[model samples]
Target: MDSALDYKMVFDALVVPAAVLTPDFVIVAVNEAFLAVMGRTRADVLGHLAFTAFPDNPHAPNDPAAHGMQVLRASLQRVVATGERNALPLQRYDVETPGRPGVFKERYWSAVDTPVLGPDGEVKLIIHTVEEVTDFLHQLRRYGEREVDDTRTALEAVTTNVYARAHELHDLNERLKRTAGQQRQTMAALKEAIERQRRFVFDASHDLRNPITGLLTELEVALSEPSTDTHEILSKLLRDAERLNEIVADLLELARMDTATPGDAAELIDLGRFVVEELERRPLTAAVHTRTDPQVMVRASRIRLARLLGNLVANAERHTTTTIEIIVTTDPPDAVLEVIDDGPGIALADREKIFERLRRLDDARRKDPGGSGLGLPIAREIARVYGGHLYAADHPTGARFVLRLPLAT
Candidate 1:
């Protein structure tokens, strides 16, 4: 029941676009927003046919204006005749203001035309409403395009950093390869030095063995027939020469231990019986004693094990002020040998360093000037080869050296 003048007041207060048209489709009234969008005064749009607003005149500057208006008029005529609200989906390029430049966006209008009936039941006026939504459509497209560009830039930076790291890694690998080659060359030089040392010791000992035996044999014969004073001097010379031979023999044996692969082990040997038999050979002024748990056996290189026990026993005898104790015992998994002497003990500081080659704790108390410092070293190395160690143990009255060898079942 609203007249065009009453509808004008309601539409003016609305935030949306509204227009009233005559039955002939002439625009009779328009709100402030619709007039602003058309870019003309209310005088230009009011009393103007919807066709004139988007005119078909040949003089109109925009060429597509006539066709666009024709299509819109046909849609509007159907809505007015049927008294229905028709939603028109206009494409991006279809909806545009005539005579406007640089304009973008396709506007969509949810338009409705309601025909006011007259007393004679004939159409008197048509009402059309439009809502402008161009800004919303424009912002959506721009944000999506910007997002794609940002993603592409981020991916490019990651790829560039990865490529740079790969190049740096390749350079580092090349340096490591060069360093490895140099190390292998150094190792080869060390191997050659070891071979030369072994050959010299073996050759020198081999060459001296025959001459030494001959010298001692001839000296013994000469001493038996010589004058008294000269015999004493010759006897002393023979004794000194024998000591030198012993040193050379010990050194030569140790040098061979380096190149010597352990010989296959023989049947288990009774360590106690072996020590007892070895004792009969040594002429000790003090009583030498041997004690062990019954059935005590060691699986070791026979020659090396014999030499290891010999060095310990002789060391104890050389230094003992009184009785020397050689105790062989077993504790479940390892067999231990303790050689005790009552002589002056080595200083606490020198205990560890005294085992090195040529190290002597007390040069003044040396009973044997010809004693080569290889005995303990040789024993330790032999123990290591058999998977064990030699350590100086606590002795309340004197020096105690303990040899621990792994017992094999």
Candidate 2:
């Protein structure tokens, strides 16, 4: 009896919610725990269907229960044939008493069914065991919700980033298009200016040529006529006309200098020599002292550079009434030629605007314009072509013109 009871105790300890159903599908035996859960004694539960013993489900163990029992029979048949454990996991109601409806009083059941075979090689009984798994199911539901939220957040972030990048690209393209259009407009304006400059030069030359030829012809006729009071009058007229012809010639030469092309420039030029040559050629009332130092060479177009210096010296000679001094000064990054004269000084207010074409500051000079009003303009254009500039300096004594050119190669 002790040995038989020992086996029974061992089996009961290993089994959970253990019960046995007979070959005819009746609840033939149940463990002490199973009977306690039903609130019944061993005799009361024995020989009843498993559902009737529990009263939560009354059709089970007579006909197989719908949930696990339906799947259990096939597994149990295989178990009986092969002599191995067959498991069918399922859920079922295990209400404690009449007070509980859908809610179980103390039982939340997850069940697994296994077959118990007879000596005749058939399944005589089926064993069922259930565990309460309420906490485990709650954890599964929480994990599922977190996964869904994380996915939604990532999708929203990607969409917003794409929208921002698209807007930035659109703005950059618009700015690039505007810059290209402005460059095109600037090129068109430069072309138009060049065309107008060409037409002006052609017309000025044509108008001045006929009068110059007639004046020269009339001067020859006067020299042949005899010396008398009438001859003196004609002589004065011829001399004035000759001066006028010279002025006209100077005007035409200045215009030609304005439109001439720059050819190959020499590698180096002597600044002192250029100033000396220009001063010797110019006829002036006052002597200009040359402080030019010959060693100081400049990188310039020799032809254009010579003409530029001649025009500037002549301009100073025309303006100054008395003494003129030419100074050649060198600086750290540039070579400067300054022509300082004792003449009617230019007004401080008009110094800046006087460098423009045909802008003589004095009203008397404007009316008695002896030379073509093109000397300064010609000088300025020459300076620009050689990467230099010509500007007037305001002074208390007289006007100052400074020419700045690049240093020698």
Candidate number of the best lDDT:
1
TM-scores, in order shown? 0.49, 0.46
Which residue pairs does candidate 2 place in steric collision? none
Off-target runs (Cα >4 Å) in candidate 2 are 1-165, 180-261, 363-368
Q: In terms of TM-score, which candidate is strongest?
A: 1
lDDT of 1 by residue, 1-409 (tens): 5454665567777766778888788898888877665456788788888877755433332523223355457657755675544443321123345667545324433344566767976667777766555565445556555777665555545444443453455346546655876898899999988786665556446445544765676677666967556766576667667766776776766666677755646457676676777778767766677787666777777778778878877777777788788888887688887888887766678777656644555631368545666688788878888877897877887688888877767
lDDT of each residue in 1-409, candidate 2, tens digit only: 3545675676556546677776555677678776555455788778876545554344333322223443444444544554555444333444446555444343334555567767976776777666655455444445555777665545545433443453355346546555876888998998887775665566456535545665665566656765545666566667667756755665665566567745555558778887787667666666688788657767887777777777777766777778777888787477888888777866778766565544455642663454545567777877877778888886668778888888875
Give, for candidate 1, the lowest lDDT window spanning 10 residues.
86-95
TM-score for predicted model 1 compared with the true structure: 0.49
